[model samples]
Target: MKKITFLLVVFLALFSCQKTDSEETNPLLNAVLYMQQSAEYKALTLQIYNNAAIHLERALADKNWTAATEQNGDYQNLPPAVILDVDETVLDNSAYEAQLINSGRSYTSESFAAWCKEARAGIVPGALKFCTAARKKGVTIFYVTNRGNAQKEDTRKNLRRLGFPLEKEIETILPRTDSSDKGKRRAEIAKRFRILLLIGDNAGDCFSGFTHASQVKRDSLVRVYQSHWGSKWIILPNPSYGDWESALFDYNYKLPQSEKLKIKRSRLVE
Candidate 1:
């Protein structure tokens, strides 16, 4: 009788430990793991960049192949350029995301700024090769990131350390100043150069309407510009974080993590 009681207690304790372990799991574990470890992720990034190279060759052959919607009127004679986003586009910041997971905290501007200042981010797969090839072909590479102007220097250091091309005579790293609408920055680039491609991980990187847009509205815009996905606008996969995740919670970053998780879970199809 005592042996049976001891066995029952042991089983209950083991079950309790399992339950606690399951509840304590970090939500970002799988996403970060995929980005850091998966061969499939590497393959996908390589494929996207290879496709971009092919399309770039095509765009260079033609003078009128302007990628930005902001580029209008007599741009055929302008020097060719390519605009790309920094975070998760050219430089991989998954290490920062991994830090957040380990620390059991949500994202904060202060923390992200600290990370940027370190300028230790790894390069995204195939980005270095692609950028180098494009620069060699005489295409001016511009990084139009929404990272605040304060991060511009550190961002440049990171890019330079990674051996990506940077033109000393021109401002290649155009960080956000007064607006997060990247279209204005693209327009600034368009003033002097013919943009051959716009590459990034977010929809806003490709066009201007995606800022703070809802999921439904974002999908609508994606359909509206369906023709540009693989060719003129190349997007790298970013499941860890982006406007897509924020759109699920209605862009309410202030919401408690639990509430945001609940809303995200509710959106999942059964």
Candidate 2:
């Protein structure tokens, strides 16, 4: 936890002079933090749960006609499947984050693995009911996550612990093996089922397995899918790290601490 807070402090101090107008305007996060300090993000998470439920119900019922094109360079034709990214969208591991953050601890793969074994995280705002409903509607629920293969047991235990429906008999939770290009896995899954819905926190998670794309490619892909943003692909807010932030720094996770701060600070719009 100390390490997590230290990273946060390092972030805040370096970027303190550059708080973007949008960052200052992020009300939901403000509310979440306030609720956290005052013992409230839990309530907000519950509220999220209700909204998640509502969103899923609406999506399932929306028989409205629209055509979506899958632009994988190789296999152009894809079939029916609703892909869901794990972590903040379906499973709420904020408790794990909270445990680290509140105690000022940083996350270790091993410690997180242990946390998964305990299986105590909450379901994201509306995820449990949403996934269950999709399954009942005969929509195949494919949990395509960036979590590594090594973390499989804990991820699965955490999902079942939180009551997420495991539709696939073997490894309903698919982990990232090579590049974080999630679309590759999505393509593999699409070979079997037509992906109807793509739900996740990160834009890459929804952009068909694009972890390693250049900034231009990422932007182009976003433009390609702009029409389907809130309908076929549902994006929930995640205030912390993602490829968007990484892109700004060229995905250089090995940068010196000060240089890291400088790069992120450069991008902060005041």
Candidate 3:
């Protein structure tokens, strides 16, 4: 009888511990974790929109082609447009990676492409409403992502699912092709857009040649664009991956995993 009672207590303690453990850990954890769990975080989209809207308004009022130009020109309130990076900028696909991590699966283009086709990715905080409001203000919002061009139709569908009201005919979609570098696409975007404001998660998406450049070149390039850092270039937060990570290893995607880790370790200050 005592043994049975002891076992029962042990089982209860184990159950309590398991419940607490589950409460402490989540399979889907990322910047959007709060949004998925809380309504308050979900509404942050509006705040993001408002902040960006204010930036654009201020830029226009100040007449800045480069996010508040010098001397405030007559074109202060001229028609405005924004360039947005797609992956991680407007869509939160980290959940798919989370799903893979939780399931002990590796990332593959085939699997990722399959996941991309789901079109279930939630919007990045504030991206949807910001773009929506910008659209209302007659600002053309264009998405410029490094996603392969094959995913174009699916990407558009995903954006539409999130209520983006895409300018499908306005030529805003800019997915990556075999020939696209970060700058190549930006140059393409430049041809059609004044591109008053630019937004994205990755440095490559935001700065052309930034990812594939030497470290010294990276710093120099950033300095050249330093003036526009926060004003015209509103970078979204992302820790998972970016061109920065690639540049750390000299942009050699063909390097073995062990060599990459060695390179990262050598560069570590600590």
**Highest lDDT, which number?**
1
Instruction: Pull out the clashing pairs in model 3.
Output: 45-126, 64-69
Q: Clash number for every model? A: 0, 19, 2
Give TM-scores for every candidate, taking all chains together and pairing residue i with residue i: 0.93, 0.70, 0.74
lDDT of 1 by residue, 119-208 (tens): 999989999999999999999999999899999999999999999999989889999888877989999899999999999999999999
Per TM-score, what order, best first? 1, 3, 2
Candidate 1's C-alpha lDDT? Answer: 0.93
Error of 2 at 193 (Å): 0.5
Cα lDDT of model 3 by residue, 5-113, tens digit: 9999999999999976754443234433554556665455456556677788776555447432221335444456688888777898878867764665545688888
Per-residue lDDT, model 3, residue 184, is 67
Model 2: residues with Cα > 4 Å off, grouped in runs: 1-80, 103-108, 168-170, 208-210, 214-217
Model 2: per-residue Cα lDDT over 1-270, one tens digit each: 999999999999878756664355432344345533543555554565555455555655554321123433322233335678887777766666656554544446788777767777667656777677777876667788888888777788788777778855645688987867687777677555555667787887776435666666778888877866666677766655567656777887777645865876787779
Segments in model 3 whose C-alpha atoms lie over 4 Å from true places = 1-50, 62-64, 67-79
